[model samples]
Target: MNCPCCSGKSYEECCKPFHTKTKFPQTAEELMRSRFSAFAIPNGEYLMDTTFPAKRKLHNKKDLQEWGEMNDWTKLEIIKTSGKNLVEFKAHYNDENGTTQIHHEISLFEKLNNRWYYVSGKFLD
Candidate 1:
């Protein structure tokens, strides 16, 4: 499938490592790309696994599956990324109803076990 990040690359080439292995993203843009892949592929396990414990929402597999089934993510664009190990961006996608939505957030990340995990996000209007 075409990359949700609009990088003109396949999802496997773009974000599979962040979902499967010990590959850690060196930049916030990379992390955002992987997160977009997680949404597109319905890899809820990977999403929850990569999320920081403090920010984790208690979701059952069914719930995650339902979420995955409900939305079709179209694109992800990095607005900006900064800080020592933190970055934020605006992600865009369409819902099941085909209404486009934009998730603008300043996301936090923490490096652990030589990997980067999503910590938290503050939504912006």
Candidate 2:
């Protein structure tokens, strides 16, 4: 299947490796893309797993999973990036009520031990 991240690559060659934990995203943008794929796949565990450890408390795995399942993830647009630790993107999806929505954010990432983790995001208009 084509990657939900719109990477123009097969899912296995694109985000599957990251989702399966066989490899980790090397940059914030890669992480962001993989996270979008995760939501499409509705893998809440992977979502929580990729979150920065320090900030994991603010998220609930079940909630993340349910949210993913509740939406139809359609596209991911990477607006910009700042070096390797930040990315601005828009995620388009349809909610449970069939309402189209776009989530725009500038996300911050942290790297430790050669792996990148999602730190946080500031929502945008």
Candidate 3:
């Protein structure tokens, strides 16, 4: 199947590796794209695992599951990036009530041991 992130690649070729931990995202933008893919597939494990350790506690599994299951993801657009540690993107999806929404976010990241972790994100729209 085509990648839900609209990366012009198949899910298996583009996002599955990251979801399975077979390959790690090499850049913040890559991580952000993979996370968007995770949301589509509703893989809460990859969502939580990629989160920064300090902020991981704020993300409850139940809440993640609820959010994951409620959204029907449609598209992902990367707006910009700052070096390799920050990214801004928009994730378009439909809610359970069939309302279209844009998750406009600017996200921060940190690299430890050459692995990037999602630190935080602020939604602007």
Candidate 4:
């Protein structure tokens, strides 16, 4: 199947390695893409695992899983990357009501022990 991150590659060739922990994302953008795929796959465990350790308290696997299960993730659009730790992207999905929605955000990532972790995100209009 095509990658949910819309990387123009199969899931196995794209985000699967990252999702499966066989390989970690090398950059913030790659992490962002994999994170989006995680949501599409509704892999709450992966989502929580990739989050910055200190920030994990602000989120939970159950909520992440429920959010993913409630939505139909469609596409991911990368807007830009600034330096090695920031990524701006849009995630398109349909809500539980079947309303199309786009989540635009500039996300901050941190590299710990050479592995990128999602730190936080600032939502945008």
Candidate 5:
């Protein structure tokens, strides 16, 4: 299947490795894409595992699953990737109420122990 991150690559080639721990994303945007794939695939465990430790507390599996279910993610657009740590993106999806909307945000990332962590995202209007 095609990658949900809209990378124009197969799931196995693009995001599955990240999801399954075979390989980790090398950049903030790559991480963001894998996370987007996680949401679209509803892989709550992967989402939880990838989130920064401090932020993971706010993202329980149940809640992530519920949110993923509520938002049927369709496409992902990387608006901009700045430096090696910040990525801005728009995720197009249909909400639980079936309203199509765009989730626009600028996300912060940091590297610790040579691995990238998702710090936070600032929602955009």
Candidate 6:
């Protein structure tokens, strides 16, 4: 699929490594980019895989598929990220109605076994 970051690259070359069992993102910014790619491809498995086990919600493929089908992501942008293993970002995307929405969040991630997993997020407005 096209790179969700709109960097004119394939998802594999852009952000798949962070989602797959390949490489773990070294920074929060990289993780944020990979998450955007996940939304673009509607890869719920990848999303869940990247999510911290403590924060993972739906474990069933059917539910994941349903969630994936419910949204149409258009764009993503990170406002700022700081601290160790914790990042704050803002993502903008168009919904099914073509309405643009902004999700500002402070995300937490933990590195385990040399892999970073999304722990949780606090939505800010």
lDDT, residue 92, model 2: 99
Return the number of clashes found in candidate 5: 0
Clashing pairs in 3: none
User: lDDT per residue, candidate 2, 9-73, as tens digits?
Assistant: 99999999999999999888889999999999989999999999999999999999999999999
Q: Which candidate ranks first by TM-score, i.e. highest?
A: 4
- Give the better candidate number (5 or 6) by lDDT: 5
lDDT tens per residue, model 4, 1-125:
99999999999999999988999999999999999999999899999999999999999999998898999999999999999899999999999999999999999999999999999999999
CA lDDT, candidate 3, residue 35: 88
lDDT of each: 0.74, 0.94, 0.89, 0.96, 0.92, 0.72
lDDT measured at residue 83 in model 6 versus the true structure, 0 to 100: 74
Q: Candidate 3, residue 46: CA error in Å?
A: 0.5
Stretches off by above 4 angstroms in model 5 are none
**Candidate 5 all-Cα RMSD:** 0.9
> How well does candidate 5 score on lDDT at residue 48?
84
TM-score of 1: 0.82
- Local accuracy of candidate 1 as per-residue lDDT tens digits, 39-117: 7787878777777666676545566656766888766777777875556677777788899998888888887776677
Model 4 regions lying over 4 Å from their true place: none
Q: Which 10-residue window in model 6 sums to the lowest lDDT?
A: 58-67
Query: Which lDDT value does model 2 have at 26?
Result: 80
Candidate 1: list runs displaced more than 4 Å.
Answer: 57-62
Model 3, range 1-125, lDDT digits (tens) per residue? 99888899999999899988899999898889998988888888888888898898889766776788899999999999988787999999999999999999999999888888999989895
Clashing pairs in 1: none
When summed lDDT is taken over every stretch of 10 residues in candidate 1, the lowest stretch is: 57-66
Sequence-dependent TM-score of model 6? 0.80
Superposed model 2: Cα runs more than 4 Å off = none
Best by lDDT: 4
